[model samples]
Target: MMLPSDFELHRPATVGEAVALRAELGEAAALYAGGTELLLAMKLGVLDYEHLIDLKRIAGLRGVTCAGGELRIGAAVTHRELETHPDVVRELPGLAALERAVANVRVRAAGTLAGNLAFAEPHADPPALLVALGARVVLVGGEGSRELALEDFLVGAYETELGEDELIEAIVVPVGAPGAVYRKFQVLERPAVGVAAVGNLVGGVFDGAPTVVVGAVDERPVRVGAEMLDGAALDDEGAFAALAEAAAEAVEPVDDLSGSEDYKRHLTGVLAKRAVQALGDV
Candidate 1:
């Protein structure tokens, strides 16, 4: 199908060029990553861009590596790539799980991690997982480059801290620190609730406090803090209940055709418990 009448396309070979084009076009231009989300929006008439800056050809933005004991994934790294990456599977199993849990084979092959986070949809799976792992996002823009915690980067549904001319560069996640798990409840392959938990044990006792994050039910991934689990023991029952309550209290879910607000909250609790159980407390 043909795009809307107002759409224009530009392919920039360099990040500098892209930023400059964005600056020149201002609100008239939109960055095109994988075009997975943007194209859909265009088709829906939610977005009308006169210029679409294509970032696909940019160099050095589609690889993964381990550096300084952290996994550095380029912004353009596709979901399929992350799913099959040996380092991701071994070091960040939760992230790999989240990647695999996305829509399906074709979408995974085309969708980019940065694109997913940049779109900042409320139901996206990766943000919650990344926040649970305490990841950081590197952004480049006309002014320069900077890094922001993934937790702070996602402000709300379909919203982010990105400027008009800014682009996500990479994501950095700590490696070899803890065992992690992701639990997702999807209705017919569409996720209704997703929870991610990471655990570290010290001297045969749980240490470093578990990180729990709830996704798909709210505008942004809700992080469950250690204090929320204070009264609960590290065992399965205690951890599960605490984390579930934390997730339930973290956000007010929107009511949609898929489910009701109350239903989403219930699923949040259920997924939270499953995530905790998957992290070995059980």
Candidate 2:
């Protein structure tokens, strides 16, 4: 690809400074961290920012912590860190496993989970599992800070609820879903369909309806209604088939190089079933 146009780089020492720069520059500025996505977009001429406010220098924006029944992942934490972090591996191995498979080793080494969600890429893997795990994002801006569900933060493909003056601070995921599993189909650099299933299954039945989320096949991660899997049994093929069908019917995919609409829909079902079965295996 061609080199991106010249842009001023600002290294903010603190979150306040970063937010201030964002507010002052507005749309002319973009937050930078793990340029795996941002730099590529800039180089490809899809985005042209006059200024890039780097958040990496902000000490508050790094590391992972656990408190109040949630895992708080910092905005600056790279995918490689997450994939290898002891806390992540122990608390949410499914997520760690998913992170290990994102893109390739290079992308994972530099891509931030916050950036991945902030970019709002439809073909990503984190959002689906995060959503199924009931993840929320903390956003800081000139007005202060606010938290919202990951599902709500993402508006559509290449779209989000983020404001020009706002930057993500962290992604908060609830703890205790040990049975969660993520499955995807990828023949290209990105997945064609991604699915995540989370629940406590024991004795061939789930304690409650499992939370299922489908991504890549749609503009954003689509959550399959819990009601659809109510009273479903993992041991029964018919029940699994019904749950899979429900997931497939929930996504509205478009034709692309990844596959046709029907093909994506089929993959969604297949992946959804596999995800649930993976949960059973856990």
TM-score of 2: 0.97
Worst 10 residues of 1 by lDDT: 227-236
TM-score of each: 0.91, 0.97
lDDT of 2 by residue, 102-208 (tens): 99999999889999999999999999999999999999998899999999999998999998889999999998765889999999999999999898766767777
Give per-candidate clash totals.
0, 0
- Give Cα distance to truth, residue 169, candidate 2, Å: 0.6
lDDT of each: 0.81, 0.90
lDDT of model 2 at residue 229?
50
Top model number, lDDT: 2
